[model samples]
Each structure stands twice: as structure tokens, then as C-alpha cells.
Target: MVTDKDGYIHLVQYLTEHLGIFENSQQQSVTEDTVMELFEEQLAAQIIMVCGQNPSLTFSQRNLVVREVDSIVYDLEEILARVSGHKATAEQSVFISELSCLIKNLFDQEIARMISL
Candidate 1:
């Protein structure tokens, strides 16, 4: 289920949702740390590393992407805290603000059609 992972970040599509429901029931399911490690190894660095590389979202994939991004936005603060040792700083504050803006624009406000990867 989704590359042998236990948890699932919600996607608008049925594939991700069903995988989550099923894999989560397995005794050998993956853990949160595994997902985090995978993200850190793959997509985590890309968030800032990519920077403003927005492109048009395809109609078929938009919903799935939206759900995944929405989950990221929801959990970003906890992720940041883990990375920053829970120490608040002006830079961190500003970054959080920007992340909030991105979440709002992408999901809540629904402004941007393009997502940078």
C-alpha cells in the first residue's frame, strides 16, 4: 500500500484512502518515523530547495495533490518544531507565516493553480 507504508496522507483519490485504511490494519505496518524519514530523504528538502517553481496543476492530479499538501500544511508546525528544537526565532516565525500563507492560498483561499515541487 503506497510503497509499503503504514500511514497515508489523505488524497482526493480512492487509491491513497484505501491503502491507508488497509495498511493501517496490518501488524507490520510502517511507523510515523518511517514516513518522516522518507519525506526528509525526498520531498522535505524540496519545499525550500525548489522555490517559486510553480507550474499549472493537471486536472486529474489536482485533488490528490491538494489533499497531500493540505495534510502537510496541517502538520508543518510540528515538523518545524522537530527540526528547530522547539526554539522560536524571528526567521522561524517568518517562515511559519509564509507556510501559512501557502496553505491558505492553496487550499483555503484556492488562489494558486500552480505548485512548486
Candidate 2:
């Protein structure tokens, strides 16, 4: 259901770049939780795009979709944490790529489920 598959790669890149910023900054106002929240919002936006402003959806339907999205985000936190902590060795990079694909699949499945409902 993801119209743009490449967006997953971009999401990973965005996460890494922002993580680097937080790591290098001396005055650290931005916490990892803040970064994760922003990432989660971006992810939720992509997954929820299938709804496309359909005002007919009931509150329960919207809540169900959101809960599924939250589940996907929770499952992805381990990969995100690894990406944040690692120095990016070749093996780790490959692992991260695999994890990225898994993340994409999770999002796709959720989007498909939302569309079907």
C-alpha cells in the first residue's frame, strides 16, 4: 500500500542524520525520545496517507489504524536503537538494511489492513 517504497530508505537516513546531530551537539536540548517521536510521526503520516481525508471514517476506525501504527513503531525501536548506537561496520550496515526492509513490510501490511477496513 506504500506508494513510495523509497521513503523507507529516506526514513532511515533521516533517523541516522538526526541521531548524528544529537550525538555531536554540546548543548543537548533534544533527547533521543524527541527524535524517536518525530520519526514516529513521519512514519504514522506515511501509513495513514491511505485514508486520504475520508471524513466518513468513524472514530473507532481511526483509533484502530492508529493502534496498529503504534504497534509497528514499537516493533521497530530495536532496529532504530541499533542504528543509533553503532559505528556502521559493513556487517552492521547490512543488518540495518535487512531491518529497514522488515520495517517497510510492517508498514505496508498495516497500510493494506487499513485500506481493507
Candidate 3:
């Protein structure tokens, strides 16, 4: 679970340091829109962190990462589907799509390696 832990730490650090991306212009305000955006950004950060630590991960550990990514994808898809029916913006869709692709690619590569081995 080192990969997962590292991912979480990195995500938390990113969110804390990059408040502008996560918080509203009012500085203390956090609307539903901002919260959703921050969640997506955190997921992306976690995916990147896990991918970067993949080389150190065992097969079982890699599988765990795959499961984690799959869960995130499912959650993201549900949220996106709900939001799309509303008034979701192009930027939000693009960000989610890009992050989803990154997570999928990393998970696929690791899973393929495990199967080949």
C-alpha cells in the first residue's frame, strides 16, 4: 500500500499548496463546483503518483493500484454522467477525460506486465 499512501500524500500536498486551483476567488469559499473540480484534480495527482512509483511495486501491489484506479474511474464516470445532464462546462469534461486516460493507461500497462509475467 506504499504506492497508495504515496499517492494520497502527494495529492494532499498538491491541494494544500495549490489553493488557487482548489479554492474559490473568495479564498474561504468552497462551492459544489469547486469541490468537484478539486476532487478531479486530486484524482489526477494520485494517478500520476501511483504511476511514478510503479517500478517499485510488486505484482500484487500493481494489482491493487489497478483496482484503485478502476474505482476512481467508476466514481468519475458517475459524476461526469450526472454533471453532463446538468450544465457541466467543457473545461471540466476535458480535465476529467485527460485524467481518466492517464489512469487507464498506467493501470493497463501494469496489468499487462503482470499477465505477461
The global C-alpha lDDT for each of the candidates, from Candidate 1 onward, is 0.36, 0.50, 0.50
| Model 2 stretches with alpha carbons more than 4 Å out | 1-38, 84-117
| Model 1 poorest 10 in a row by lDDT | 1-10
Highest-lDDT candidate: 2
lDDT of 3 by residue, 1-117 (tens): 322445444543443453333222334332344445545555667666655755666667756775675566455455444332233344444444454455545455655676467
lDDT-based ranking: 2, 3, 1
Clashes of 2: 0
- The residue-by-residue lDDT of candidate 1 on 43-64, one tens digit each, is 4334333233334445554555
Angstrom error of the Cα, residue 34, model 1: value is 22
lDDT of 2 by residue, 1-117 (tens): 232346555655655554544344344333343434555655555545634544555678667556655665664575466444323433333334454455546555655556577
Task: Please estimate how well model 1 matches the true structure, expressed as its whole-model Cα lDDT.
Answer: 0.36
The TM-score, computed over Cα atoms with residue i paired to residue i, of candidate 1 is 0.28
**Would you list the clashing residue pairs of candidate 2?**
none
Counted clashes in each candidate structure:
0, 0, 0
Using all chains and alpha carbons, the TM-scores for the candidates as numbered come to: 0.28, 0.40, 0.37
